[model samples]
Target: MKANRKLVAAAVGTAIAPVLVLLSPAGIASAHGYVNAPASRQAQCAQGTVSCGQIKYEPQSVEGPKGLHSCDGGNAQFAELNDNNKGWKATPVGSSVAFTWKFTARHRTSNYEYWIGNDKIATVDGGGQQPPETVTHNVDLKGHTGRQTVLAVWNIADTANAFYACIDLQVS
Candidate 1:
């Protein structure tokens, strides 16, 4: 039985070896999160309320103008699960936005969700979190155009250094 198990392990390792080779050192480093729109500040808002930008996949360094911020500032706790998955949220507060948020697990979030004016209309999923790395991130609020109340959340709680984001988006 042990010999059979060894053989199975070897076979699995061999199969996985080819797949692991494609992940560069940088790719491995990015297993935590990704930085979206490092230079651009304007992310589109559909329904004129739900706009987003500079989504960090694994809590990386975010850079923008002084007023531009994404996620909160703190270490991510295990309990901050339902918040924004390293992305920003927008809700039209007299053309701005607002939302309640918390923290989440590292590299565990499958995607993100947003609600514009009480209607949950968007979700950011598998375009980048998977292995291929060719996924894209964007949203279109053409159909559910309504009043928006940005609901932004992130992962930050009971952690050594809390992971956070600036919960604001430059809507267009």
Candidate 2:
């Protein structure tokens, strides 16, 4: 009877192990990367400039499938990032501003692209090499001005997905 009980306990543990791993923070941490400077929506939450849920813990992990442009990275847990009414502070930036990215797990990059209000503003070709801990690009705002949201994308060189970071800016 004791042997049967032990066997059942082991079976239960084995059955739940995969579920536990999938729900672990390490699994989420693998998502990687976010805009650090200029404070992307997730960054603000992570820094306590804004109150958020799970994203506040792993701000660098607000990732989603590529080709979609959304501030929350399509992760509903980070949907707070999509909330415009949260009073997300917009950083004042010049026409040519330097944007920085913080990566927890750096992957090979195909390119970096930036968009402001439906217009593609800048694209930096990142020759299929892993970036440093932090990467910065000087984006030319050109004719854009006033308040705007900058959507930055880091396209993975080997994967079909990309990480997205959206920053609210007061461009001058």
Name the candidate that leads on lDDT: 2
Question: What tens digits encode model 1's per-residue C-alpha lDDT throughout 1-172?
Answer: 9999999999999999877877656555433322222211112121122233333233333211222123322223311312454232443333322322222224333444444445555555523333232223344543543432233222222222222233334454
Model 2, C-alpha of 131: deviation from truth (Å): 0.8
Q: Give the Cα lDDT of each candidate.
A: 0.35, 0.88
The predictions' CA RMSDs to the true structure, in order, are: 13.9, 3.3
Error of 1 at 107 (Å): 5.3
TM-score of each: 0.29, 0.84
Which segments of candidate 1 are over 4 A away from where they belong?
Answer: 1-31, 38-70, 73-109, 115-120, 127-131, 141-168
Report the Cα lDDT for residue 73, model 1. Answer: 29
Candidate 2 lDDT over residue span 10-98, tens digit each: 99999999999999988865757999998998899889998888988888877778877788878888888878898999999888889
**Deviation of model 2 at 122, angstroms:** 0.5
